[model samples]
Target: MTEEAQRRLLVELGASLFQRGYSVGSAGNISIRLEDGYLMTPTNSSLGRLEAARISKLDRDWNHVDGDKPTKEVFLHRAFLDARPEAGAVVHLHSTYATAISCFEEAVIPPLTPYFVMRVGRTLPLIPYYRPGNPEMEPAVHAAAKGAKAVLLANHGPVICGATLIDAVNAAEELEEAAKLALLLRGMSPRLLTPPQVDDLLTTFG
Candidate 1:
């Protein structure tokens, strides 16, 4: 796709997430890989109010080359993109329930539903927390992202990747929903999808 089209798509998707409360204020960032570089949401820009023409553009070396400045958490997106060449886009957000799940001792959300198992995969890595924008967490995120579809940041939120930009947004939405379900069933003995069930979903989805 052309850069202009990608920028518009980001604006559309970002607005969708924001209107649904998946993101608030200037608390989230989105990016798509490009043949020569990348296109990312600008620093401190509200996803609900993204200006497609002003989306930040970065060169192959990650240097900002046009439009607005990119998010300070560029390290978060870079880690996943560099680690997984197949990851065409990344979406990082501080959605409510998913952030709550990050604080749990569990490293991953249980297989609560077939759609969750299909979109998020079986192992969701939880990275130790770092102050927002700290590059110190890059190595850990990079390593884990190599083999996982998504990772939760302790006391923070989720970083999801996909083969396409919309896929990333969809997975991000699914994760938040699953997290919400997990919280609702917190005190109850919910029947989770069994190992074989999860495996079947993965095979079918794949």
Candidate 2:
């Protein structure tokens, strides 16, 4: 895709996620891969009102190439690019439901429900909490995201990666829904899918 197209896609996706309450009040970031560099949202910018032209661009080595400075969470973006070569886009959002799950003690997003297991896989590993934009946080997320497209950051949020921008956004949205389901079912003795049932779904939808 052209640079302008990438920027427009970012703006549209950001707005969509914001409108859906996936991230609010400038609390998330999005990025897309490029042959020479990458495009990302600017720091402190509201996803609901981002102007495409103002998005930041960083070259292959991560130096500023165009527009304003990139989001402070560039570390996490770089980590995903380094670890997951096939990830053409990455999205990090403070979606309420997912972050809520992160606050729990064990912090393991168990695949108790079938839909979550089938669409997002068995577990959304929750890495130890790290301050937002902290360099250390990227390494932990990168490690946990191996072989998985989505991960719930402990006491933080969710980071999703995909081969396309839309796919990444879809995964993040699905993650939030799963988290919401988890919260609603907590302490209610919800009937979780059996291993064989979950395996069947995984085989069909995973």
Candidate 3:
């Protein structure tokens, strides 16, 4: 996509997430990988009110080359992109359900549905708590991201990688739904998809 197209799409998707409450109060960031660099939401910008022309642009080396300043959490996006070479976009969102689920230390949501499995992958890595926007966590996140496309940051939220911006957003949304299902099913004996079923889904859709 052209830079203009990417910026417009980011504004649209970001607004969609914020309006529906996946993000609120300038609490999320989205970035798209470009052949020359990246297109990202500006720092302190509300996802709901992004200006396409003012979206931040960064060169491959992470320099801010145009538009507004990039998110302070740029390191978070870089970590996932560097670790997952095939990823073309990344999104970090403070969605309520997923953030609530992240508070737990070791709660891995089971594959309660096939869409969740296909979109979110088999394992959601839980990165130990790191203060948000702390570049110190980049190395740790980068290491964990190497093994999973979606990871829940302890007490923070989810950082997801995708083949495109929409893919990342869709996966993040699916994860939120999966977390909601897990919480709703708590204390009940919910039958999760078996290993072979999960493997089949991964093989077919991952």
Candidate 4:
């Protein structure tokens, strides 16, 4: 995507997220990997009112290439992009349901539903708790995100990677939906898909 197009997508998605109550103020961050560096939402900037031209750009070596400072979790973003060559965009959101699920001690998001499996694969592993932006979190995310499009940071939020901005957003949304479903059926003796069903779904979608 052109730089201008990338910037506009960030602004659009950022605004949509704030309006939908996904992340308030500047609490979340998003980024797109560019040919040279990356285009990212600036630190401390309100997603609801972000200006496209002022987005941060960071070089491959983590140096600021343009605009203001990048998000503090830049290393977190870098870790995934480094490990997953398919990652073109990354979104980390403190979406309510996902974060709430992340707070649980045994927060394992299973392949409860077919749609979740199709969109995010069969697993969204729970990375052990680490303070936000901690170097420790990066490795944890890397480990959990293997063979998965999304991973939940214990007591933190969800980090989703995709081949495009919209794909990343959609994956993030799916994580939130799965979390909501998990919470709603917390102790209701809900009928989770059987292992065979999960395997079939993964074969078709994974």
Candidate 5:
């Protein structure tokens, strides 16, 4: 996509996520990998009201090049993109259900449905907590990304990567639904997909 197209799509999708309550009060960030570098939401910018031309642009080395300043949580996105070269986009959101699950000791939401396995993979590890906006969390996130496309930031939210922006957003949404299901099914023996079933889904859809 052209730079302008990517910027427009980012704004459109960001607004959609924000309007749906996936992000609120500028509590989330997004970035897309570009052939030249990256385009990220500006710091302190509301995802619901992004200006396409004012989105921050960074060089391949992450140096700010144009538009507004990038989000302070740039390292979070960097961690995922660096670890997964195939990833074309990264999304971080403090969605309610996913964030609530992050607070628990068991961070890995089980495969309660086939879609969860198809979109979010087999396991979602909980990265050790780090103060918000702290670059120190990058290494931990990067390490976890080696095994999974998504990881819940303890007490923070979820960071997800995908081959494209839509895929990343879809995975995040699926994760949120799965988290909600897990919470709703608490204390009940909900029928979950068998390992063989999960393996088949991963093989077919992943």
Candidate 6:
């Protein structure tokens, strides 16, 4: 897609996620990899109100080249994007259920459904808490991204990446649903996808 098209799509997707409550206020950021650089939601900008033309542009080395300043959490996206060559987009959101799950003792969200395993891969590692926007979290996130498509930031939220913007958004949505399911099934033994079932999904869909 052309740069213009990517900008428009970022605005559209950001609005959709915001309107649906996936992000509130200026609490989330989205970034798309470009041939020349990247297009990212501006810092302090509400996803619901993004102007395509004003989205922050970063050079290949991550310097701010145009538009407003990029989110301070640019390093968060960079960690994943740099680690995974196939990842073309990264989404970080403070969605409720997912954030709640992050606060729990377990560092990983268990496989509760076939779709969760299929969409988010085999595991969702939890990165130890780092204050939001702190560059200190980058190394941990990068290391976790080496093996997982998504990771839950302890007491914060989720960071998800995919080969395309749509794929990343879809995975984020699925992750939120999986978190909801886990919360609802907590304290109750719920049927989970067995090892063979997870393997089958991975083999068939991956």
Q: What TM-score, computed on C-alpha atoms, does each candidate reach? A: 0.97, 0.91, 0.98, 0.94, 0.98, 0.98
Separately for all candidates shown, the number of backbone clashes (residues 3 or more apart, or on different chains) is 0, 0, 0, 0, 0, 0
Q: What is the C-alpha lDDT of each candidate?
A: 0.93, 0.83, 0.92, 0.85, 0.94, 0.94
Q: By lDDT, who's the top model here?
A: 6
lDDT of 2 by residue, 59-176 (tens): 9999988888889999888878778898899999999988998898776555676656755777667778788878988778788677677777778888888888987888888788
Question: Runs in model 2 with CA error above 4 Å?
Answer: 112-115
The digit string of per-residue lDDT tens for model 5 on 108-194 reads 688898888988998798998899999999999999999989999999999998899999999889999999999999889988899
* Model 1 ranges off by over 4 Å: none
Identify the runs in model 6 with alpha carbons over 4 angstroms from their true place: none
Q: Quote the lDDT for 33 in model 5.
A: 99
Order the numbered candidates by lDDT, best leading.
6, 5, 1, 3, 4, 2
RMSD of 4: 1.4
Candidates in descending TM-score order = 5, 6, 3, 1, 4, 2
How well is each residue in 43-135 modelled by candidate 1, as lDDT tens digits? 999999999889999999999999999999999999999999999999999999999999887845888998888888998999997999899
Local error of candidate 3 at 70, Å?
0.7
Model 3: clashing residue pairs?
Answer: none
The predicted structure with the larger TM-score, 2 or 4, is 4
lDDT of 3 by residue, 121-183 (tens): 888988888888889999988998998898888999999989999899999999999999999
Query: What is the Å distance of residue 200 in model 5 from its true position?
Result: 0.3
Between the candidate structures 4 and 6, which one is better when assessed by TM-score? Answer: 6
